[model samples]
Target chain A: MFQTISLFAPQLVLAFFASQLLSTGAFAKRDISIGVRNFSIFVLLIYSVIGFILGKPTGTAFKGALVIDDFSHYMNLIIGLSAAATLALSKSFFQIEKLDRFEFSILVLYCTLGMSIMVSANTLLALYIGIEMQSLALYIMAAFNRDSLRASEAGLKYFVLGALSSGLLLYGASLIYGFTGSIEFTQISEAISYGASPGIIAGMVFLLCGLAFKISAAPFHMWTPDVYEGAPTPVTAFFASVPKFAAMALIARLLVGPFETIVSQWQQVIVIFAILSMFIGAIGALVQVNIKRLMAYSSIANMGFALVALSAGNESGVKGMLIFMSIYVISIIGIFACILQMRIRDGMVENINDLAGLSKSNRSLALVLTVFMFSIMGIPPLLGFFGKFFAFVPAIEAGMVWLVVLALIASVIGAFYYLRLVKIIWGDESSHEFVEAPKTLRTIALMSSLLVFPILILPLISIPTQSLISRAASSLF
Target chain B: MLIAISFYSLAFVSVAAAFMVVASKNPVHSVLYLILTFFSAAGLFILMGAEFLALLIIMVYVGAVAVLFLFVVMMLDVDFVELKQGFLSYLPVGALVAIILLLEMLMVGAAYFAGETKTVVVRDNGVSNLEAFGQVLYTDYAGVFEAAGFVLLVAMIGAIVLTLRKREGVRKQIPSEQIARTKEKGLKMVDIKPGVGIE
Candidate 1:
């Protein structure tokens, strides 16, 4: 049990602290700061150190179903770090809104815990369990604010669509299990590649649909904007960033490892999704007024970029994805942090016009947001530029010139909206009143702002980062 | 042999009930049909030697999800008054789907029957089937399985997110405000006296 306990130690600690605080009635209905955010961050840091200590694939829990590896360990750190950022930013948002205290942080931590397990899965059963755990925690997070009708609506819409996707995935898994007479990922993968059973192909298609939804790729991304718009800003930010990383990892791991040998079919499927996601993400964001919805579209477009990297089906592509996602996640955190800090009067302050004269009010916050927008636009000298570069460089290297070209157009289109946000923030005065963000909110903005500068600090790190990405990619094979 | 028949039967019942579930006009019938489908599927699973999965499906899907449907149907005041029979327009599409399914099944069956294949003898749990699955699961193809699981996990979370959500502008309390008041312990009893009373 101690062995099993070790695999779970990180999450256990989160749960333990959350329970102790919540049960003590300390933060239960009181002023925010249940210390949940701080606790989650500490737990994540601990998990990272422990995971680093464990190094290669090691299992201490769940009878080998829940195992830790370099891939999962690294991702756990990312998820933890991102969750921490989300926590740091959330306090001010809640403070401004005058909403219920920090239970949302606990919810966010729980979801992160689920995602951590998910990335560590070995068997089909473990994989499913991890995913559900992550999703269930997230679902609550999405609708954490009970009073907001839109939030509840977002949760419901996500639930219905998500349920359908899960059913499809389950059906597909069953088919794979049935055909191969096994549910182990490796065995079934071999059965698909060498055997090429019709069941396997069908199963793969079904499974991909579920993956598509998670990544919010097009043709299957209908629910993204609605949910993004409906949920609270920080929760939406979490959706826009962290989950996609895990989803991309999942895609890279599953498709490349198992379906690479049968790339023709899977590649065609991915190509369609990639093309659609890019076009939709770019074109859709063009007219959107809501910042949250705009970010959602941005995420959709980003997923397109990630998928384009994925389409190449190699180690380079995977590395590109990691770099792309890392940078993208930071930029998104910044952008949403700015959005979270906005103190709107009409509950409609999310509109682009509402941001007019922001430059006059909070010049510093305005400037940080500008950097985030540029980064998202893939402008050079910003973190967003490198994310796009790393993701695309591999595609060109893979002889995917056309994809690179289309992606460029999409980037330009993406830039259009991102700059619109820039203009709205720094543009001429439309309103006299300037929204002020609390101290905690400022930190998130600063961190998000700093993400743009990290690229300048070390152009050399990209090489090693790409190397790690490549190694992680090959590890799947 | 027994296992195969039971598996096929369960699958058949589930499929049939699934069709019926959609076809039935009454929500009650639909709910019942779905439950039967789940149970049969569970039975089919049992035949395949996945005791855990078989039991799990029955317990979770049949026992929980389908039962949930039953409760929802029972509770909701649905207006079946305006419902009319629409068999005429739906027939062609239904028949088309059925034919396609039949063709697909025939193709699969034809390949199996026409091709020379060795019979797979059902082994008795192989000393331990769980261990066997676990061994293969952890190695070689672990990545794909994990990815699929992540997909499911995301879906589950997405479902919860989609449903249990709220909107902007609704007033709520700050977590800090709630906790700070309690820690300060502001409710203190102070002693006050008048000069006349003291005398």
Candidate 2:
């Protein structure tokens, strides 16, 4: 019992502090939104450090429901850092919009807790609960600005679609349970190793479909663009980065864990999802005027690339997925931070045209935005190139050369919109006079750009990250 | 034989009440039918020897949920006729959904019968249903149970965060102010001996 409790201490600490923040917000006489937001950031950073320190001891706790290992630790670190960054980014936006509710920070904390549980889940029950917890916070956050009809519609649409996906997941779980007589991933894998059953295959398909929706892969991505466009810029940033990484990590765990034996059955489905997402994400972004909607498509394409690596179904696959997602999260956060700074005299801008001549107005901001765009475009000498390189090599090694080629083509097509944004920022004439961004947001954007740009050149940062990712990936197998 | 008869009767009642729940025009009547359906479902659970589930169905669903539904249906001044105006136009899509559901169920049934899926056997443990349930829930599923608690907490917070607004000019009670009221603040020692004189 002591062992289990100690192994689960990080999550417990997060939940404890979150509840404390909730009560503090509730009882405080004066508005303490800034304090709460800063405190949440502090707590998240502390949690990340603690998770890293506790990364050495890898074991299952609570009768194998929760697995504490390098993989989970890596995911926790990503979730924690990105969550804190998101909170810091939201501070100025909230104040400007008069949404100074301390509950926002507390909800982000709880949402981070949910993602933590998701990455560590070893049982289907834990997985479902974790997903629900995360999604509930997200639904509320999506509609945090309740006065806007678009925000309310986004929330309702997300909730309805999310409920449907949960139902499908539950049905799949029940089917798998019925066929295999267990809900534990280890036991399920054992059962499958004996012999795969038709019911199990169907259940796996259903489960994959549900998970694909959570990751916003194609065919299940109908809700992404609207939700992204309608949500507040900061909330959309949070939506884009942390939850995507968590869901992708969860998918990796599920595929490499219980479904490892039945790879043949699931690989095809993942491939189709990958192909569709790449093409659709690439093609869909061509006509979108809203920058957020374009990002929504970009994320779909990014996940498609991650899925390509995941289709490899080996140690390198997980490693590549983690690396790709980490880089993706960093660049996306930087991009959104830049987006958050797109406010002019009237209000926050969302159109691609709003970025016209940003280079002329705010030189440094434009430079940072250009770097992020190029990085996401997978231009050489940037971090995103390595992310995509690592992702593609594994799939090619797994005899998925055709899929890799297709992905490369899709990425080439996807680069057009990114370059367009750069061109608008640097070449086009100035349209709107942009306001200066908050110090914290500017710092975050610059820092992320630095990470995406010079970190590749600096061996110190790249080597440690590579070693950590490899250890994390090898632990899963 | 007795068990079978009781099962069939409970099932019949439950299905009929469920059908009435959707078919009934009056929202209040629909809520009442929903309660009846819950009751019969609880009865079916009892027949299946899951008394704990039966009690839960009665206590949670019939007792709390159904009552809430009744209150909402009674309190809301919604026009049911206007709401149903699009029913005819939506019938084709609804029917398509119904057909798809029916086919899926049929497919599942066929797969179950044909596939090599083994039925899970319930072992006859000497403990009561509630005790067994508690043991499994608290021991094996303790982590998941705790996580579920967090999910519920998120729901609660989400509800309040989304809907609870402190509007201006709305009179509300301040408990501290009420409690801190002293004799000097609450009571005026002025004696109005005569109403005309006081005026």
Candidate 3:
């Protein structure tokens, strides 16, 4: 019994604690923050241990739906750590709003659990389950503040768009099943080696569409900006960071594992998608006034960068994509944590222009934000540059120099907006003054922004991070 | 041959009701039409020798999800008049997409029918669909299977969370005491005077 229970120890532990937290209404009345912060710490310390242990396990468990492996273990670690940051960020946001925290924290935990499952999933079905679990929790968080009209509208729009994507995904799965006669990735891989028909290709297209929606790739990214803008800042931060990491890993896992045989077929589709996504993400973000919306477009471009690596269909490319996304998610979380800490006369100051004269009022926050902006713009020494550098190198190695060049152009174009934000913060003092920062806000901003220090000092940690990337990517291929 | 009739009937019902679900004039009619579609789809699953899928369709989709839809359609004061807006505007594109889908399906069906006749070797391992399915669901194909369950679970939870709300105009019961009730103290059978009803 102990052994059986131990097989599912990670999931069981997460689920048990999540439920206990829910039933006891433990954090309902408190700062709503205390629970989330503690939960974040608990998850981080525990999962780091479990991730190492998880990678050491061999063979299949719970039938074959789960593969406890080195690759999954590394990804689980990255995803868990990202979610922990989200939790820490959430605590500060809740404390600021004085909103109910029980429901919010539980949703984040469950969502993290879902993403973790997706990274470890051995089947397409498991991946979808994980995606949906993360998505559903996110949808609620988008509209968690039901009182806000925009938030409610965001949730509704997200739901409708999300439902359409899910339909396409299921239809694609069904069509794939039609061709392979099996939904298992390995079986499908074997079946495809013999070759696939147009029906199968169509299914793959629809499958890509569903995933694109999740990651906010172009042509399927219409819902992203609105949803991100409407959602609370912390929720937007989580959206920008955690789920994308999990989703990208799964995307790499799926393509590198079973779909490698048909790279030529899918690569064409992915290239078109990637180029469009990069262009649209960069171009669309340029004009956006809302910081969250700009980030949404930025995310679309980021996913496009990841896709460029995916299109390479090689081990290094996959490894590069994972590492790139890890750093990208870190910087995004750090940036957004600062954004969440911003205060106005009302709840928040959401517009870009409102940030004018920030340096005069809060010099420390402004300086940290400049670091974040530099990283995002791919400026040297900051973490964001390495993310783009690694992501594009794989493309070049794969003989996708044309696409890499396009990505480079897009990144250059994308940098303007980040620089613009910096100008607002540091350039000139405007008439408007920043409202006082709460203790919670100060703590999150200080901690998350300090995260940039490591990225800036990447020379020190690049080797270990690089090795983890190789180890993580080794399992996928 | 008898199996063909059941298959044809289920297929016809599925297609026809699905059409009605889109074409119905009234929102209520659309909801009812969708329920019919679900039932027929379930019946089709049964004819395909997938007993579990057939039951799942009936229990989860037809029984619960469809009922939820019906309740929403029934309970909501939908301004059915506004639904007519842009109907004609959407017709051409919708029709084009539909026709393309139909053509694609027919082409696939033709190929499937043609292929089976060429390789008609029977290799049934005396295995239930459930057994092979379970194996695949757990192993190499496990990701897709779990994704299906997770998607459904998310949808289910989302439905409850999104819809079960307290609207400004609508009254809702508070569940505080409902949850706090002890099994020992909640059930009381006391007589009251006819003119004085218990408040």
Candidate 4:
């Protein structure tokens, strides 16, 4: 019992502090919203540090319900940092939108706790519970601005769809349990190693469908655009970055751990998801006017690329997925930080055209946005190119050359919108005079852009990231 | 023979009630049918020798959930006629989905029974069902049990955060302020003239 608790101490402590913060917010006489937000940020950073210090302790807790491995630790670190960065970026946006409730910070904390649990889940039950916990917090955060009808609609849509997906996931889990006679990943793998029944395959497909919805992969991505468009910008930023990594990590664990032997059965499903997501995400974003909606599609496409790596079903595949998502998360945070700074005297502008003449008005901000755009477009010498390169190489080696070629085509098509964004920011005439962004948001955006920019040095940042990710990925096998 | 008869009867009632739940036009009637369905399902569970699950179904679903549904259906003034307006247009797609689902379920059932898959059943340990459930839930599944608690906590917080709005010009009771009132503040002794109504 002690060992189990110790293994999960960071998440336990984070949840306790989150509850404490909730009560403090409820009881405090004066408005201490900023203090609470800052405290949550501090706690998140500390949680990440503690997880790093407790690096890769190989063990299982609660009788193999949760796994403590390098993959989980690395993913948790990324989740924690991105969540903190999200909270930090949210401060100014929350104040501007009159959404300075302290519950927001506490909810983000709990959401992070849930994601940490998700990446470490070793049982179907844990996966379902963790996803629910994360999603419940997210639904509330989506409608944090209760005064807006769109926000309420977004929350309702997300809740209804999320409930359906959870139902499908539970049904799949029950089917797997009935067929395999166990919920433990190891036992299930053992069961599959003998032979996979048709029932198990159906369950796997249903489970993947549900998991794909979480990552906003195509055919299950109906809710992403509306939710992204309607959710508050900071909340959308959090939605875009941290949860994607957690879900992807969970999927990778599921694939590499229990479903490794049944690769032939699931590989085609993943391939279809990848091809559909790439085409749909790339095409869907072309006509989108709202920057948030475009990002929604962009994320779908990015997950497609990650899926291509995952379809390889090997250590390199997981490595590439992690590295690609880490870089993607950073770039997304930078983009959202720039988006949050798009405030004018009237209100915040969300249209792509609204970025017109930003280069002349806010030269540095435009430059940061440009770097992020190019990075996401996977331009050579940028960090995103290396991410794509690593992700695609494993698939090519795995005899997925045709898929890579198609993905490249999709990405080429995807680049047009990104370039359009750049053109609007730098080329078009200044239409609206924007107010200055907060120093913290600007600094975060600048730092993220700098991280995405590959410094021409002997040891590039990707080298260290690759090494760490390879270690994490190898732990799964 | 008696157990089989009772099981069939209970199953029949439950299935009928479940169908009525979706087919009934009145929402209140639908909720009542839902409770009936729960009761019959509980009966079926009892027939299967799972008394603990049966009682749980009655206590949790029929007792609390059914009552809540009754209250909501009664209190909310939703227009059922307007809601059913699109039923005709949506019938084809709904029926197609229902048929596909039925076929898939049949296929799964066929596959399960025909294949070499064998369900591993736990041998009887001479303990009550509730005790056995508790043993695993608190011991083996403790992590998941605690995590489910967190899920509920998030749901509670979400409900309160989304709906609990503070409105101005509303009088509220402050127990601490009331308790802290001094005798002088609460019970001021006043001397009044005979005909002076405290103007």
TM-score per model over all chains: 0.81, 0.91, 0.87, 0.94
Q: Summing lDDT over every window of 10 consecutive residues in candidate 2 chain A, give the lowest-scoring window.
A: A48-57
How would you class the docking of model 2?
medium
Docking level for model 3: acceptable
Clash count, one per candidate: 39, 0, 19, 0
Q: What is the lDDT of residue B104 in candidate 3?
A: 86
Regions of candidate 3 where Cα sits further than 4 Å from its true position = A1-8, A26-33, A53-55, A438-459, B116-199
* Cα lDDT tens digits for candidate 4, A351-422: 999999999998999999999999999998888898899889999999999999999999999999999999
Model 2, span A193-271: residue lDDT tens? 9987777887898898898989999989999999999988899999999999999999999999999998888899999
DockQ of 2: 0.60
RMSD of each: 8.5, 3.3, 5.6, 2.6
True contacts kept of each: 0.02, 0.74, 0.37, 0.83
Q: What digit string (tens of lDDT, one per residue) describes model 1 on residues A1-477?
A: 555556656655655654464444342555546465566567656655565554444453554455555566667767778877877777666655666455566566556666776676655566566666667666777776767899889887887888888787787777666666666566666766656656567778888988788889998999999999998887888899888888777777678755667877787788789889999999999999888888899899999998888777777787788888888888888788888777755442678787887888878877888888877788777777878888888879878899889999888888888888787777668575644567777887786688676654485965665555565666666
Which candidate has the top score in TM-score? Answer: 4
Which sequence of candidate numbers ranks them by TM-score, best first? 4, 2, 3, 1
Runs of candidate 1 exceeding 4 Å displacement: A1-33, A53-64, A345-348, A454-457, A460-470, B1-13, B42-65, B81-121, B125-199
Worst 10 residues of 4 chain A by lDDT: A456-465
Ten residues in sequence with the least summed lDDT for candidate 3 chain A: A24-33
TM-score attained by model 4: 0.94
